[model samples]
Target: MSETWFITDEQAAQQALEAWREATVVSAFQAHQALDDTGYIEAVETVIADPATTEKTRRAWNMAQEFRRMSPTVLELAAALELTAAQVDELFEYALTIEA
Candidate 1:
């Protein structure tokens, strides 16, 4: 037997994007230093392509991508994690600004 959410690629894309947007707004911690810029973004896109990326996990990944910058290093994470652009985007969301 098998199970599925029946979610389309477009829907997954939207959810993955939203996940990152939401994450950035809420996650206040400095990103995992190990994670390069675009690290989260690549992760989410990979999720969108993967069969295992559940809605719940995709949402979590989005939260992770938010507030992060876009950089070339995304490629490194992509290669290492075997992720896609959308999956990386899924890792994060919006972010609140801080006053210095």
Candidate 2:
């Protein structure tokens, strides 16, 4: 007897995205909170005002900005993962609402 299991590319991509989101966002949020407590907002502003800044601070500021803009649509997520429209739709049926 033989058993077969089938999984589409869309399913695989969706699963990967879901896992990535959970891991990345959760840690980013925690780091943001810690930075927030330490006057990180002022630090970001300072870096922005000054053309010359330490690489460490600039990296941190960039990370904070990236996390702030973390909202990902199905299309954006799909593009990032190189998923086709059909694959994205298979995982994100709700994307149809945006199309209409």
Candidate 3:
């Protein structure tokens, strides 16, 4: 038997949102680097036209498109977590810093 650790629903939601934000930042950064190295539009067109593209590559390309359109925002997290306006504002401020 192993010990089980439990957290409040709010705590769990906050943790999940934080993890998602971190992942978004890292993914966006890597995607930006790749696009910058290869030429953004050209790289995306190449990736989409290539039949041999791996799932991971496709995912990165999709993320690049989304990031280019609008970097992921804390409003998304807030909606997913059902957070209050004040909490969302706080998270939004922190999220803005993640990419920088």
Candidate 4:
């Protein structure tokens, strides 16, 4: 179970998004430290197996879901969740957004 707290800290959310985005660069070896030997191979296999994922998250996930990867974004998730990307990004749009 998760603790429920009603808080509207927009700045905090923005900061969180920044962290997630940075993670994106590191995972792809475009920036930051690279993954260890085993993990790197595993990741490459995952991506090649399914090179489809939300553009934002494709880096961390092995591959995008077959059908879902077609259009990866909060908009797509929103479609599944019945919401808009813009409406979702502020809440979930960070570098980690791709991971989720």
- Considering every candidate listed, which one attains the maximal lDDT? 3
User: Candidate 1's residue-wise lDDT over 1-100, tens digit each?
Assistant: 8886698999998987666544433232434322334355445366445766455544445455533334333334455477666555544322232211
- lDDT of all predictions: 0.47, 0.45, 0.48, 0.37
Q: Whole-model lDDT, candidate 3?
A: 0.48
Query: Mind giving the per-residue lDDT tens digits that candidate 3 earns over 2-62?
Result: 9999899999999876665455433455444544453443644565556765555455555
Assess candidate 3 and give its TM-score to the true structure.
Answer: 0.25
By lDDT rank, best first, the candidates go 3, 1, 2, 4
Superior by lDDT: candidate 1 or candidate 2: 1
Instruction: State which candidate, 1 or 3, has the greater TM-score.
Output: 1
Backbone Cα, N, C clashes tallied per candidate:
37, 0, 0, 6
Q: TM-score for model 4?
A: 0.22
What TM-score fits each model? 0.28, 0.27, 0.25, 0.22
Error of 2 at 96 (Å): 28
Number of the top-ranking candidate, with TM-score as the measure? 1
In model 2, which runs have C-alpha deviations exceeding 4 angstroms?
26-100
| Per-residue lDDT value at 85 in model 2 | 54
Candidate 4 wrongly placed segments (more than 4 Å): 1-7, 14-33, 37-40, 46-100
